[model samples]
Target: MRTTKTLAPLALAPILALALAACQDRTDDAEDPQSASTSEADAAEEDEEEPAPVSILRPDIEPPELPDLPEVPLEPLDLTIGFPEGGMELDEEAKATLEQVLESEQVATGAPIVLRSHTDSEGSDTGNMRASEKRGELVKAWLVENGIAADRIRVIPFGEQNPVAPNALPDGSPNEAGRARNRRVEVAVVPVPEETVPDDPADASAEDAD
Candidate 1:
């Protein structure tokens, strides 16, 4: 009986040790739950507090407006007068044509007209130059006699230096027809600019009073 009582105490010692270890493990598990929950909550809060990234694209810019310009006057008329064959005098048809051109609305309004005369390569350069000048002066005189203002006309004489026809004739001789064709006058009218016109005196006075 004494031996059995000592063996019973030895067996109870192992069971008590096991029970203590089990209690320690359960305590650690219970403590870990709260710590894990706190960590998860912290992660969620950080996600909610963060801002989204912005774009790098910019808005389009607009162009500025341009200012308006003042208007210019209308263009003038052009008139071509051919001289007679082998003659320096103005023909009847050419004179009539000149009269008609001068009577037009553009020339009547005192618009500036430029008269350029040319001669063929038939004559010497010096003679042709003189002829061109004479033709231009004659036309100017005719316009003046027909009531056109002298100030509104300008004359330029370009002799054989500028030929409309080639120097070679059909028969291989210097063609007089080409020379005659070159010996002509061209009239060009140029309109005045709107800005050059004088302002009304009444409008200026009214603005000053204001």
Candidate 2:
């Protein structure tokens, strides 16, 4: 009986050893897939954290700088309109000159226009003043009829006081040519007032939007 018990324990020992070895192999196999999955997840996370490198189509070449343009000053217009001998009316030549002047950039900006009218020293001072005033009114009326605002025009009658040429020559003779030049209206423009700019950036932006 003692011999049988010893033999039975020895026979069962190999089976027990085999079962423990099988369980150990299965555990290692299962843990290997989980470890591989964890390694793959860590590799994916690294890829997400790193940013891709930017590719430049033209890294060596740079754009050229443009030159600044020069600013030109806007000068006031100084034009003249001459009348025929002893006539307060504007002839075709005078009209042509006025049209050309009005087309100029200096005069086309709707600025205040000054018309200084003058006459030759032919009549009395009072008569010359009245005639010069009449001539100026005629010119102003014409301008109003042709789309110019009446308020924009200012007529100043100089009469014979500001004659371009002497009515009589140095030898006390009538200088017809000089007298003819004296009957004219000097046309000029008032300079435009400069605009005030806001110092605040927000105010400037609001003005731009407006």
Candidate 3:
């Protein structure tokens, strides 16, 4: 009976040793930051996969070539140009109008262009006069550059002397449209003398045929 009691104590000692070792392993796993972080990284990596590359199929036939567009020719323009307030630049519409004037047949005949430039009542008399003259010179320069004879262009600068439109409203407030209208350059073609018929026989025969 004494021998059996001693064997029972040895058996209990091994069982207690195994229980302690299991508890120690569980504590180490809980305290390990690297193990916890590794688990989190693995979970994140499993959430998504890389996208596949896209493939496009090319067309079997070639495309046709586009035809060039025909350009419309410019005509004559006896324009009244409205300038931006105090600006020397001619806007798109004004430039297009000038193109028409340049493309006219009469312009090629060296017909004189009378340029009447005026300014809005917005500055001192002398300043307005100078600015208006400069504007006139700019227009003349453009015309001369585009093949119009320089001597044929007559520049007349009227610095706020003749207001085509009222510079201000009845309440003394500035009228923008009026001011814009006042700042203008009027263009007109000078007339040439009509020559007498020299009695051409060919022209007379052609007229008789008509």
List TM-score per model, in order: 0.56, 0.61, 0.54
lDDT of 3 by residue, 96-202 (tens): 87887787765765668988899999989998888788888888898888877788999999999988899999999998889888888888774454556757888
Q: Higher lDDT: candidate 2 or 3?
A: 2
How much lDDT does each candidate structure score? 0.82, 0.85, 0.81
Separately for all candidates shown, the number of backbone clashes (residues 3 or more apart, or on different chains) is 0, 0, 0
Question: What's the candidate order when arranged by decreasing lDDT?
Answer: 2, 1, 3
What are the per-model C-alpha RMSD values against the true structure? 12.8, 17.9, 16.6
* lDDT at residue 41 of model 2 (Cα atoms): 100
Write the residue-wise lDDT of candidate 1 on 135-185 in tens digits. 998899999998888888899999877778776666788766676678789
Candidate 2: tens digits of C-alpha lDDT, residues 50-92: 9898877587887778888854657888888887577877999
The best candidate by lDDT is 2
Candidate 1 wrongly placed segments (more than 4 Å): 1-73, 196-210
